[model samples]
Target: MKFKSAFYLLFFFSAFLSFDGVAQNKHTFEIKQGNFLYDGKAIQIHSGEMHYSRIPHQYWRHRMQMLKAMGLNSVATYVFWNHHEILPEQWDFEGDKNLAEYIKIAGEEGLLVVLRPGPYACAEWEFGGYPWWLQNISGMELRRDNPEFLKRTEIYINRLFKEIGHLQITNGGPVIMVQVENEFGSYVSQRKDIPLNEHRSYNAKIKDQLVRAGFNVPLFTSDGTWLFEGGAIDGVLPTANGEGNILNLKKAVDQYHGNKGPYMVAEFYPGWLAHWAEPHPAIDASNIARQTEEYLKNDISFNLYMAHGGTNWGFTSGANYDKKHDIQPDLTSYDYDAPISEAGWATPKFDSLRAVIKKYAQYDIPDIPAPFSTIEIPSIKLTRVGDVLSILEKQKSVQSTTPLTFEQLNQGYGYVLYSRKFNQPISGTLDVSGLRDYAVVYINGEKVGELNRYYNNYTMEIDVPFNSTLEILVENMGRINYGPEIVNNKKGIISPVKINNIEIEGNWEMYTLPMQEAPDLDNIKKNDVFNVPAKTKQLQGKPIIYEGVFDLSEVGDTFLDMENWGKGIVFINGINIGRYWHVGPQQTLFIPGVWLNKGSNKIVIFEQINSELKSEVKTVKTPVLNKLK
Candidate 1:
């Protein structure tokens, strides 16, 4: 008995020693003179950007392992301000939204970290990563030095710092560097011969705020290599952000410190983002491999903008400008054709990058894990629960105080309802001046008007046979992408409602439909001709709401394809899947299967446009929506 007790004691001591070794092995890194240092030793940082909310939590460790094997020493991530504190004072740190777990996993894989906690990250994200709730604030000017903007920004920064401040290298954590504001130079100094003094002033204010908020690590500003000189602040390190090439890198080194420090590429674009209606972008893997090799050969530090470009998911994707004066919003799939594909699979680019990194690594290359399995789903059907229009009638209290324009209403995230009573027969051009995007007009439950932003005009001649109540429901759809005109993105009717070239002013009831509440179909009315359905009911074969049961018995990672179905929302068990439209470009929806249950998992879909198309859900396979011919 004494011998056995001695053996158990020895085992406990051994386990303690093992844990201590692991704790010692874990390192915190710092950036000094453009080079990251691990425990006072100069180390090159090859980082990649992968948001925690974008990729599945189960895949976090796997993706980090892949990044480490590919010769990357760091994982650069953006802590989206809106993603955290999604609701007021409500914070989520589990599943895919687990930011701390992501960083901790990077550390476990023997990689450092660069945290880009953007109160405003403009990563082609919705509202430039700012919370949609801020738009509800009256006269809120984002990215400016306004008190309201600063107050919210301060709260976000303070809260985020509280969560991850001690995680920085200075505090014995893995975070090496923190970026102040992303690509500010490009936005502020886009025009020729424009002095960047204002831009610098704003940056200084941001830097001061961050420092005061407890981000003491080395702060860097990233801009395109050629444009670095214009946006560079004196004390802060200026890093190049774009495709990693020799000439541009050399130029960045010169512009940053004049040959006094190491060179770094903050945003090495492995692949470009795609906008709707634009051809899907495909970057050559061979070119990326060659550029990565060149950077490694020169001992330059670079971070792939998106090592694993996951899904924009929900209404979080942003828009961009095209050549035809069209404002193109980004698709749901953020598959930027990156080294690690959206599904977290290692592509040919991944292998090539691994080879290049292995050639220069002082340590042995780790084993590349096998790709995750794919499961194909059979076709199924979906049903409509009830109409959305009738529900609006129940909430007659949704009307706001005082007749408010779209700007005054300050409802920027979802749909808006504008209703007014027309007392007499009217015949003239009914004009909705400054309609932000799309609007549907109805008179006494008859669909009489439709206005779109394609032509930048929202005018239609209407014949009101008698006194009737005119209701116009306008959807924000999304804001404009290109040109200086993007700043004036006001939803609903921006100007005024007019008839016969005269402004129609009366008791105009404006309903703010931010869609923050769960949709209810029972509240809908058949007389309500405008609203769509809320829930689906059908359950059978083709076009049937496919109800499948699976045992997640173990939590893992996977993606969901949303391209095959029409416009509708998805739900896990009972949670809303957000909205998915088969409208060109965005073909797949991301399902971080990690959020699923071990047994009896449920998926409910509500397809708005197509009732006959078959829909399926798979565990392993990623869905790709075919373009409508």
Candidate 2:
């Protein structure tokens, strides 16, 4: 028995040598005879999913190290389209947006790559990873056979390949496979209006786009096991997602690929995503351990959906819809209850999975790296600088006969203000039909009530006087990232406004407040005049921007406790950290150490409703993920 164990260890060590040595030179990675062949030798790929855009650039190496330590040989990542191309003809690939640098760093850390460059990645990303500008293009029908959408997609694919094309396996880089499109099979089932041939043709065009862009790696498609008939690309490997039944997965792949081998689970869930106002989702550590062991025992390659889910930071988080929750926007933290916490600390799930790998993995596992340090900050004083209503009036506005959607106005994300004056006194049902998300109705700058789309609330009773201005401040919480409704996710008002069932059209002023960059508090004039009439009510129901400064002797990652504050977004040193609501489930926003300075640092908040008028924020060493309203 001892001799047999020694021989097995020697055999794996020699196989590792051959794999590592060939990676430096040109290598052949293919599927043949029921196995994944690397230089004509069978190998199992142990990969984990992590997005480069979601994590800070400075900590990429550290996160990759964590994956390696967990016994993962390969790292998979989705290249978000909107993250790279903010606007049409305006592409950003430097600094944190650098893809080539990220891939090179992964290779340096001794991990192979499986790239998922999605023109439409439904990873709870804004607009399903489609650039907002695409909605403005004439004749644009996304994720379809529309020429306009395909033309723009082709342009983006070509430009992206120019940046990381040489990193493919054929070019002596670590990249092994490239995914064609993300879960098109599920979309096909949802959108039955489009013929199956069109869906297949659209997918084929996307695959062609990737190949034309110079990706010579093995191309593949991923879908749920039952939908392989709709999602599988001809002559391309089909992989399963969220499948635990290895037998079912193998049968599905075999049925689609004519009984070939080299089966893989593209997205195996170790943990699930959490949303605001919902219980934080968690998978038992022991259950995950059993699953990991099952995969190893079956010789099946699988990638953990999110080995380390990071923050969604800024306005990039997306929304989902179902019969249960009307429109559930994802929480700011993409923690996903993953094996690695949002702050880069390993959880019990990590330990259990690592133990399984140590016992069954053919290759040797690396030691877990030291965890990152965190610090707590004392409460810092904040003061109201200016209210959003007053500041918004100063910006330019367009006069329209009817309220315009964010896409129609050519504004991507953020808040939009719609204003109109009533000539005659009117009181009754004040309803806004086709409201994209949330809106605060105001009469002469005083808050009357609010309509939240998440709850399907769009009507309210109101009493108005003659010659009073009626304003509706609408916020684009996030666009739908999944399901058939994503095609109609136009922000702001999509329909018309009505009073007592009478349409209020014409002479409307619409202001596009994208909030792409945080306001420069030092330059903006401060306002001492209060908007609320009550003496105790300071900026009640008013959108106010508060500014504060704190000094940090040493820099370390921390969580800003926004439990006391109401719904708003926080910015540190002019960088938009993320959004926080009093609704619960997510009571803190992560502050990366890299974003902090050693000396004085500035913080800003765009508070939409401050009933308590709280003017301070504290940083804690630990996160509060389960706090509820």
Candidate 3:
């Protein structure tokens, strides 16, 4: 009787695991008549979107567990091409970029995976995730049937598949579906220059690339409801993005998916994305809960666009194009007003939505884990370490008759210093042609004026005596992530420098300041003499590097309050956390505890616009994401 009881218990547990979609055995995941089937059983994919590139690897398991606790059975992620391959043929999959490890963690947490590996993932990421080097390729047309683009894309997909392709459900991995070419229908609509059929053909080519690269599971395309006609592939499944109406979803899927029925909302927004100057976007928790209930009741599978909106970290943020703000660069903190805050804490929306999910979840939901605790640090005073010129002295400069773009210089992100020595005193309206984003003009190390592309301000007044040096520091805020303008998006001064409408011709010195990592300031201070100012004062638009160090007995996640500082990038130890701007909205940069050391930790700030009278930064347990300047 005891043996029978043990056997019965074992049978019951195995059945429960299989029914709950937790069993890791090789299973068939298919789309039949628009619904998903796992091992011949109908299943609803309660999934959420989370970028492994955005979240710290140390906390990936925690975030996965958070999603599981919210009753999600699946997790979706976009494999950013630019992120994996920072440079052409130079790939990085170790450390935080470990994509396979992230997916395995999701499976360990009993969640299926949906892979959206876009050579162009417009998640407000840099260049829509296209490597900057692609622009340097001759005749490289992106998202089209261009041979140059396809050749590189095929290479990228094959390399990516080798990393996570075997993890598909057919191979005993969690990945059930793979997406091809993100939102191509919307892109085609925006770019009227390209024919509709060409866009569709290009989409088909990408889908073929995925299959050839060894993706054996179902493939799908996601676009807004109105975009399905152009976005959907003939044989592949179609998913809706941003469609709240159940009727609209069904109609679109039926219209596009050969009258089939496995409908899924690929990107249901719990909270909207936040821009730099825009008000924090928030959808009421009740509204999300209501929509969720409707989805569950109607048997519509859905995935939260951002279950946890993580930080953009470093120069990874992208900008948007519109009539309102010409080049609206996204804030470094991609808080997105999401269910999980930038620091990985669950919000009211998470709680309320989780409650709704509990009712429909096939299995018991795990208890939500406690959010990570934050540590506050005492104020640390920063010293003026060195100027940009001092740092440039250590690097090589390219001499060109015309100013080159960042790509021309083989530089991806950060600032480029364009300088020319004037033989005679020159005083006139200084104009820069094709200035990609922002520039700070200086004459003999003194700032003269500023030019911003967002406001379409390209010309500025300058009066410098003869034999003085004129330098224009151009900053690539971010590449345009969406729209047709991306084809023309190139950083730095792409044209000739002009004075009073006359093009100034001569030898120009270009300095590359790609701040991919923090500069060795300690060595610079030791080797070079930095004259300390007698008193603290405003930077007067002069870009300066400030360095500070603080010792910690213990460390945890914390927010570095940058209210007192100005527009610049912050680096902890040698790793760049992200950029900070005084222009309101995001006043703090989230620093993960794993990135922080228990001993002495160094902080470096490359202040361009604003710096406090007292150069200092404070740490807070809570974030100041909503605070706008």
TM-score for each model: 0.82, 0.95, 0.94
The parts of candidate 3 lying over 4 Å away from their true place are: 1-24, 525-541, 610-613
Q: Write the per-residue lDDT of candidate 2 for residues 510-578, one digit (tens) a residue.
A: 977777888765565545333233242646777777778888899999999999887878889888989
Q: What value of lDDT does candidate 2 attain over all alpha carbons?
A: 0.84
**Across residues 1-629, which tens digit of lDDT does each residue of candidate 3 receive?**
22223222322222322212324555677888556776665667778999999998999999988987787778899989999887888899999999988888877676788999987899989889999899999989878999999999999999999898778877777789999899888898888888888888899999999999999899999999899888899888889999999999999999988887788899999887777776777789999999988888887888899998898999999999886567888888887878888888889999998898766554567798888777999787776556676567566789888888999999999999988998899788898857888888888877778898877888888897989999888899999999888887889988878999889777888999999888766557543424335333434456878788888999999998887776789999888999887776888899999999989999988888643444577889888878776
Better of 2 and 3 by TM-score: 2
- Of 1 and 3, the candidate ranking higher by lDDT: 3
lDDT of 1 by residue, 103-214 (tens): 7677666666788876667777766676656666767766655677777778888888877776675655667789887776676655433346655666677777889989
lDDT of 1 at 559: 44
Provide C-alpha RMSD values for all models, in order. 7.8, 3.1, 4.3
Best by lDDT: 2
TM-score of 3: 0.94
> Which structure is stronger by lDDT: 2 or 3?
2
